[model samples]
Target: MSNIVKKFKVENGKGFKLGDFDPAYSDGFKKIEARKTLKDLIDETFDLQTELYAANKYALLIIFQAMDAAGKDSAIEHTLSGLNPQGCQVYSFKQPSTEDYEHDFLWRHYRSLPERGRIGIHNRSHYENVLVTKVHPDLLLKEHLPGINDVKDIDGKFWDKRYESIRAFEKHLTDNGTVIIKFYLNVSKQEQKLRFLKRIDNPKKNWKFSAADIEERKKWADYMDAYEKAIKETATNDCPWYVIPADKKWFTRIAISSVILDTLKGLKLKYPVLEKEEKDKLDESKKQLEKE
Candidate 1:
């Protein structure tokens, strides 16, 4: 296990306080130092991922949930660099489409799960059903779940039931060989504001800025409350959430890569063993090739 993993992990997530974490925390690595560490992490991941692909047993699911400008995209781009693209799939969940609205909240996410021997990365995941929806309960009417027409009746029990659904969903995945690691990029409001401004000022990044992002920023407290409650309800020993500081993009990238590499290494994966008959066949084939 990596020493840094525990530093960011949300153990016994119930009653975990988001306030206890610092979004600007960087483990004392300045940008240049962190960039060097990031390179090393990316290099080490390729062999580990090849082992995972060869072992063909466990699938890894990485979930990143964060407010705008928290650098989820950069984290995914930087941390997973040099990974075998064939062994990985990344999905970024956006607003639910009409098709998404017709199914259970987890259905869309379920379709994107990684198969055995692969890594599935969710830029934003099913947790949105709790975090964003919890912050904006009005969005629930769109789901059209049974017995939820009256928004007034949608009380604590409704959210609690949703939390139960999330727990069961993750537990089911764990039982079926999928390992889940959830990350909440804890970015400060001030940092997010600065990032958003950068996006606005930079021509290349102007399109990335959304008025809705600023609108969402206004409700940061509500989102934080929702995140706290959802993490409390759904976090477990099998599927843990890591709230990583994101004020420094470099640090976020390295920290995330460390957790991912540590998780993959901890699996203790091995290549498939060949039987004597298989070994003999390979040796014979090698001899025939030598003759050719």
Candidate 2:
């Protein structure tokens, strides 16, 4: 196994434990260098990802969960840019539609799960049930979970149950064939404010800014609580969450890419082999063409 793969072994079947792995632990200018290194790692990983796709032995499902302006879109755009479009699919989870609300919370998510021999990216995944819903309890009106109304501590129990459900869902995916990698872009509040302000001030980025984003910021503490608990409770070794430090965009990108590359390397993927008869036939054809 490669060093990257050794660094990302699954522990206790719940979460991945990176003991001393720090992709962005550096000073001012050095951090920039680290980011570049990370980009290279991601590029290399995509090379392997294409091979894995061709091998058709396993599927990769990447989940990106982060607060607003935490660089989720940028990470996905840049990190996955090199992957073959046909082998890669990206799903951006938005507000649940009426039809989405009619089904269970995991309903929409299940539909987007990656099939065998492909890579699927989820921008904002089903964890919304625990994160966004916890922040805005009103959203729960869309789904009907028993005991939600009856429980006095709705926020606590609500998220706990959701975490349990998410764990089970991921375990099922792992048992079948999908390799699940969950990332939490842990951007500081100060960094988020700066990003949000940039979005507001820049004319080109204005369209990306929404007034409701500020409302969400007001409940930052609640969201943090929800995220902390969800990660702690549900980060099994089978499908673990990587809490990426996003204060530096470059570092965040590299760290993410390294983690991803590590995961793919561990899968021990390779190009498919042809049968001896097929190789002999190809060799014979080459000899016949040469004679012509």
Candidate 3:
């Protein structure tokens, strides 16, 4: 892996701290240069994606988790622009429905998995269960989980179990054919405030602003603690987490594309080779088409 992208990977998240990363990091690449670099990365990823689909042996699941105003949407849009929509599936998870609450937290996400030879993108994925719910433990009541009927039931042991479940779930996916790549867009609180103000200031971006966003922002420290603990618990070699610098949208997109390209390259994907009989059949079909 290139050193440029390797620093962001958290294969073993021991002592991982969000404070250690700089959200404004650009690695000396200016916006103008980053655009071209991102384009090249996307082009290569697109080619590999085609081979991944044709080979039909693996499924890539990309999960994005971040604070509001962290530029997750734009990063995904720019980084994956070259992919064929037919071979990609993107899902954004928000509030749970009545049916969703009835099943385990991973249930809905499990159903959304891409078939072999496709890339599945989760805008805000299962990690939210640990993140938002951890911040607001009262939300757990909605799940109707057995035990106590109050937030007091959610002790440290409960959180440990939840983290264990996440680790095992990801392990099972990797044991099969699913390749999981988790990304945490690490935007600074100061940067988030600037973005919030920009959204409020710009008429075009006003719709993106919400009162609840402010409410959530109030619990920033709690969210950070939750994220830090969750990442430290679940990050592993098979399904590593990439804590990307997201203060600058251009740099965020570039860094994300680099990580994606590296992951796809490691897969060593190639178009399936035809057997002798298949080659003969193709030659015969070619001859018939030519005659026609």
Candidate 4:
């Protein structure tokens, strides 16, 4: 296990201040140096994932949460680039549809759980229900939970239940052979603004920029508070939240890849062993073919 990865993990996310984590902090690696390290990590990941798939006994679920333009998309693209597509799946959760609103908050995410022997990556996950909805409480009205009302008077207890629900949900996954590793891409507000500007300046990035993203930026402080509390409530041993610094794109990729490699290694995954009977059957078939 890498000691540096522990620096970024929130064992107890309680009192985690988004401001305390330096988004621009890097381990002094230039792009050239970082990519070399990253390549090695990716190779390790490919071999590990191959074993994970063949073992067919465990599943890995990776979730990413971040502020807009915090590089979630690119991070996913780069870190998991070496995986076999057949053994991996990526699901990007956007706003819910009319039908999605009809079910409980976790229903949609439950449907997306990775099958055994595969890796599932969620771009933005069910945590949004607690983070984004907590920031904009009024948005909760749209889903219309039984006790909620027009008064907009939800108390802390209301949030307590939601957090409890999230914890229990993850615990169930872990008990059932599913492993969860979550990442929160923590980008500084100043870095975010600069990136937003670059998006506006670059013609190719224009489509990524939107009026809604600007509006979301206006509520950055509230979002930070929401993320802090949500992470504090739900981070657990089976499902830890890694707060990755996002200002240095290259470093962020390497850190994420390293953490993922360490987790997979800890699982001690191996290809399944064939029974003696199975081995004898193979030998018999080979001998019969030779005789023919």
Candidate 2, lDDT over the whole model:
0.79
129-177 in candidate 2: lDDT tens per residue? 8888877787786576666564344765566677788889999999988
Instruction: Answer with 2 or 4, whichever has the higher lDDT.
Output: 4
**Candidate 3, RMSD to the unseen true structure:** 1.0
> Compared with the true structure, what per-residue lDDT tens digits does model 4 show for residues 186-243?
9999999999999999999999999898899999989998988988898877788899
Show model 3 residue runs off by greater than 4 Å. none
RMSD of 1: 1.1
Candidate order by TM-score, decreasing, is 3, 1, 4, 2
Q: Give each prediction's root-mean-square deviation over alpha carbons.
A: 1.1, 3.7, 1.0, 1.4
Instruction: Please give the CA lDDT of all the candidate structures.
Output: 0.90, 0.79, 0.92, 0.90
* Per-model TM values vs. the true structure: 0.97, 0.86, 0.98, 0.96
Give the Å shift of residue 220 in candidate 4. Answer: 0.9
Model 3 C-alpha lDDT per residue in residues 47-142, reported as the tens digit of each score? 999999999999999999999999988988888888999999999998999999999999999999989999999999999999999999999999
Q: How far is 161's C-alpha from truth in model 3 (Å)?
A: 0.7
Worst 10 residues of 4 by lDDT: 11-20
Index of the highest-TM-score prediction:
3
- Evaluate residue 234 in candidate 4 and report its C-alpha lDDT on the 0 to 100 scale: 88
